[model samples]
Target: MALRMADTPTPVRHHRRSRRSRRAVLATLASVVTALVAALLAWPGAEPADAAPSTFAHPGVTVSRGQLDFTREKVNAGAQPWKGAHDQMMGSKYASLSRTPKPRAVVECGSYSDPNYGCTDEREDAIAAYTTALAWYITRDDRYAKKSIELMDAWSGTIKDHTNSNAPLQTGWAGSSWPRAAEIIKHTYTGTWGNSGRFATMLRNVYLPEIINGSNSNGNWELSMMEAAIGISVFIEDKGSYDKAMAKFRTRTAAYVYLASDGELPKTVPSQNLDTRAKIVKYWQGQGTFTTGLTQETCRDFTHTGYGLSAISHVAETSRIQGEDLYKTDVGERLRQGLGFQARYELGEAPPGSLCGGSVHRGLGPVTEVGYNALHSRLGHAMSNTQKLTEKNRPAGSNNLFVAWETLTHADNPS
Candidate 1:
């Protein structure tokens, strides 16, 4: 007979059953794995969806698109405060189209001792480029965009390196502006920036590497370098560089700006080997009075102190744009205290003789807007001294080193 009652063959039947069992097991395993993966992805500690984005988040870096848009809207409607600030910037020589570009192969700047040729020129050009870019963004004028592009292109096309004692500082100054201009233009303007790639390459090769490692000369040097590194990291969407720069920035800021809660001495970078109190005190310019808002460079001069403060503000602002709210952290507190303390002196209050030997070299510069806006406007903190100074210096301009046109960009900025 062809078929039997017990079915075909015992071995064949067993084999078919075994195959079906295997298939069922495999399916069950796959389902379990999928559920586990989904759970993991939903976990709080899961990896960020985009640790780094290509274009950076809108209003990314230091100034966000929202902030820019607000400025534009206010200026267009002829609002009181922003309109006046914008008018001041446009009237300034920084926004002038007649500005010239001076590019060099190697920029060498000594420590206020011997500044090489093209050092000042390159820094000013970079600032002018940023100023023009801001003008373009606010007014939607093609000429401003074109001029900004021209200035950036000139530097990218010609400059290859930075050298000398002031190289890092010079690089920090020029480096600070380059990425700001590039970020605004590359993201906002529709015009052709054919050399954008070259510009990116310039930042990556020439600027990022120089400042990414940071400096040990002074608080300002390292702070400014960190500012450059942070800005460039945002432009290039370098998550690694961004994290590294931010870590360094936090450490340096803690050390640079002091608070009474920090215990007996200011926080010190372990890499700097400032473990001993003697070394720390000396590094702090022989100032034993560790009060709130006293900076490491306070004994040196308010000008240098302003540099450190400016970098702190810039980094904090950029961090906020990138989605981290550092303004409420110890960083922000230190900044607020520092600004207020310095503002008191700048507002004509006589610094105590015990402080900085009563010879506080004062010239706080245009460094208050960013911190003032963050601490006062955003957080609703009572920053009486800072508010006074910031309002007094309406339309704050550039320090010609790194800071520029902060009043126009950050004055009462809700964003």
Candidate 2:
């Protein structure tokens, strides 16, 4: 019968038609499958039209639940470096039980040259709050948790505005720690924080608006502010704010960290109006020699450069926790190069005469922990200079401006 059908002209034509129909069906299926995969890759965890997860997903933000648990386990097992760093944090004044939070109606901090009265108190209290939170997390002590809540509530309830010229920087400094403390206390602590809502409101109303717009001042100013904005956005579960902060962070990071591929000059923020080469050179502190790892604030000093680098790492880490891996992107490369370049100099490499007039101002601070953990341990990147410097500076502590207890949180953290 098959031979008879094959020999039939009509049947042969029918068979050919069937084959074409099958091919068309298969091709359509393949197109659909390809489209779905493309969509998934383009926007992970969100529909093509929908925004990403909004609201503070517990164990989200800069530190994830897995990471916190890992830290706790290491600390409990009395792991070498973790134990030492834990002792360092718990022994500091920031963790003292007798610490009192001094809340002000208005905090007015001038630049370094002209400081204000409550500037130190505000910054220290914020640090102390974070310290107590770490203590609570490690020890399961109710007292420490309560103390952390008290500090947050004190500032949230009393502080209405940050005034004067140093307002943004002050807010950035305190704002950065508040969310880290809040995330730990709100998610991990079993104790009831009645004013936690007020704290959220404070962040959303007072801090978020101030920093979300991004700054055009020195690169450090905007970087630190965006760092605060990004952390607060995660805590509040505001995906829109998070996106804005991340975009600005990318721009500022590129401008701050120079790469050889960027031609003879470092990149500048387009909005900053550094259109002319001369203008860009001026903004870069007149340092014309552009190379990998050179920062916009390098000529200013390493201290400011450290601020920029720390903020970039913090934002990038937070983004990674949110399921968006910035480390695999250009942002990550910039951060890695920036950290390596700074670490090399910090490790006692004298500057060449072609760069910064043959001398570099060194004060990169304790800012290498998160970046080191991400690049070295997780990704298996060879960062010898950063690794050596990080090991040499184990139990990295706070810089007193914003960065604090990074070694305790991020040192060799696989999670």
Best by lDDT: 1
Model 2 spans with C-alpha error above 4 angstroms: 1-56
Question: What C-alpha lDDT values do all the predictions have?
Answer: 0.85, 0.84
Q: For model 2, how does the per-residue alpha-carbon lDDT over 35-85 read when each residue is reduced to its tens digit?
A: 877864443112232223544466565677788788889999999799899
* Least accurate 10 contiguous residues by lDDT in model 2: 1-10
Cα displacement (angstroms), candidate 1, residue 215, comes to 1.2
| lDDT at residue 29 of model 1 (Cα atoms) | 75
lDDT per residue as tens, model 1, 95-185: 9888778898878778782866788888889888888999999988999999999999999998888888888878888888888888999
Deviation from native of the Cα of residue 295 in model 1, angstroms: 0.5
Clash pairs (backbone) in predicted model 2: 55-237
Task: Kindly give the number of clashing pairs for every candidate.
Answer: 3, 1
Model 1: ten consecutive residues of lowest lDDT? 1-10
